[model samples]
Target: MALFFANGATFATWGIHIPTIRERFGLSDAALSLAMFAVAGGAILVMGRLGRQVARLGSARVSMLSGVLFALATGIILLMPSFAALLGLLVLFGIANAGFDVAMNAQAATVEAAHAHPIMSMLHGMFSLGGMAGAALGGWVLSLGVPPEMHVTAVALLTAATALLTRPLLLPDAIPIDNASTTDGQHRRMLLVLGTLAFLGLLGEGAMYDWSTIYMRDIAGAAAASASAGYAVFSGGMALARFGGDAMRKRLGAPRLLTWSAWLAFVGMLLAVALPRPWSALLGFGLMGVGAANMVPVFLVTAARLPGVAPAEAIANVARFAYVGMLLGPVIIGAVSHASNLRAGLGVIAISMGVIALCGARSIRPAPAEY
Candidate 1:
């Protein structure tokens, strides 16, 4: 979870500095977006293979190495002298992020089994909390006229220290699935359903993270500092709700919790799109965080517990879908934004979440009693 926190902090810090980098490089908006896509493209190419690599290297080693590499790659971007160097650093950052993502999720699944409880949501919650801190701190520091390089350096040091501190908690053991744990054809169908739902959930999340602030500032008439607050509030609400989601899941069950979460997120998106006020938009973002808090974690836990697939295989499959969503979500939103208004683009996200709420329950049935 601390690793998740550090990863979020690093990503958010970089995101806060994107405009600065673009201005420094004299990049057109299209060029900057393409550079972002280059990063995602790198992750898409490597995430699956990296998951298998984690199985061989063990989670602890992969997590530590990826964390260190991520920090180093992000720090290198601070010194980029041209657009080409920045793009290269972004690609490297993507590789580090994809590797770390697989390693950490694999580790979290193992930890959840050991604890015999719902913990993944809380772990991811810490990531959201860290993102909130990073964005807020980055904005605050930038407002004070600090150089982007200094900000990136401070975040890098913090990431390295945190990664070292948490290295011991990630164990080296793999999931020991019994050979008898085979499933019928139904399990394959279920896996497909769950993967699709995960894709949609991640799509909504990625869209919000990548575009919400821009929508607020450019369309909703928010100041730069106030625009950033949308992301901070969204992340903060997500973190807080995820910390408590285990109890909620126990009380509500996965099916109902997911249904309600999707509905809430749908409404939140609608609120943000419909309300023109900046504060209203921030409130909508908060609702979005609360509603999305546990959806992905629940999907992860559910996928791992499917009848036939080993925990590792299930995680890898679902993770592949997640990576696709993370890669495609922003691009799709950007395309829509270019063709129409940003609000119309975000409306598609709202509609997608609504579809997930309506259809996702059928994709993940409860496991049989004897499994």
Candidate 2:
């Protein structure tokens, strides 16, 4: 849990410094997009292989090493000699971040197996709490006129220290499954199905994270103060929901939970797109958060438990598609909105959620595990 918190806090440091990095480098919007793409591209590049590496080396070791690298890469960006250097550092940062992500999740799966129950959602909730704290603290420091370099450096050191300090506590990773057998027909098909669900789930989540505020302000005609609340409420709902998601999964099971969650999301987003009122949009986004909260956790838990694949390897495979969806969702929404209107763009969210509900009769079936 502390590792999750450290990860979130370190990521928050990179996030809050985005505008500063832009101004410092004098980058055009196009250049900034390229830089952001570089980060995601590097993460994507590594997901396929990092899983094997984690399996070979153990998640505990990989988590510590990658966490340290991630923090250092994040801290050194402002210290880069040129724009090219910053871009290079960002790519490394992304790679390290992805490694940290897969390894830690692999660790979580190990812990969950030992407990013989569900805890993924609760661990994810800790990450959410950490993000909120980090963002608030970063915002405060920025408001007080702290230098980005200094701020990032301090957070980096703290995160690195935390990783080292907590290194002794992580559960040992699962034994590696034979790679050849995992690619057999059934496992491959299961991977594809899980990947699809992850793609759809994260597409909605990424869309909300990037566009909800704009939707609240532009379509709903909200005041500036109220507009930001759309994101705040959405994030809050997600954080809160994850804390409850374990119990929900225990009680409801994935198929029924997903069906109900999809319907909940469909209704919530429908309310927002149809009404176009500030408070209504806020309520809608909050519900969207609740609906989206458990999908990834359930999918990941299922992936790690797939019969023959190493838990780490399966997670990376699933996350690979998820990252792609998250990367494209905002762009897709933006293009659709450009062709039509913002409402139409957001309507994509509603339709996608509806698709999950409609098609889930077949696609969501998984091994009879307690995930």
> How high is the CA lDDT of each candidate model?
0.80, 0.85
List model 2 lDDT by residue over 339-362, tens digit each: 999999999999988987776535
Residues forming the 10-long window of minimal summed lDDT in candidate 1: 172-181
**Candidate 2 lDDT trough over 10 residues, lowest sum:** 174-183
For model 1, the stretches where C-alpha displacement exceeds 4 angstroms are 141-147, 177-189, 214-229, 274-282, 307-312, 334-343, 367-371
Q: Write the per-residue lDDT of candidate 1 for residues 45-109, one digit (tens) a residue.
A: 78656755776667777888888888888777868877887888788888888788777887887
Evaluate candidate 2 by giving its C-alpha RMSD to the native, one decimal: 1.5
Top TM-score hit: 2
Count of residue pairs whose backbone atoms collide, per candidate: 0, 0
Backbone clash pairs for candidate 2 read none
Candidate closest to the true structure, highest lDDT: 2
Alpha-carbon shift of residue 1 in model 1 (angstroms): 2.8
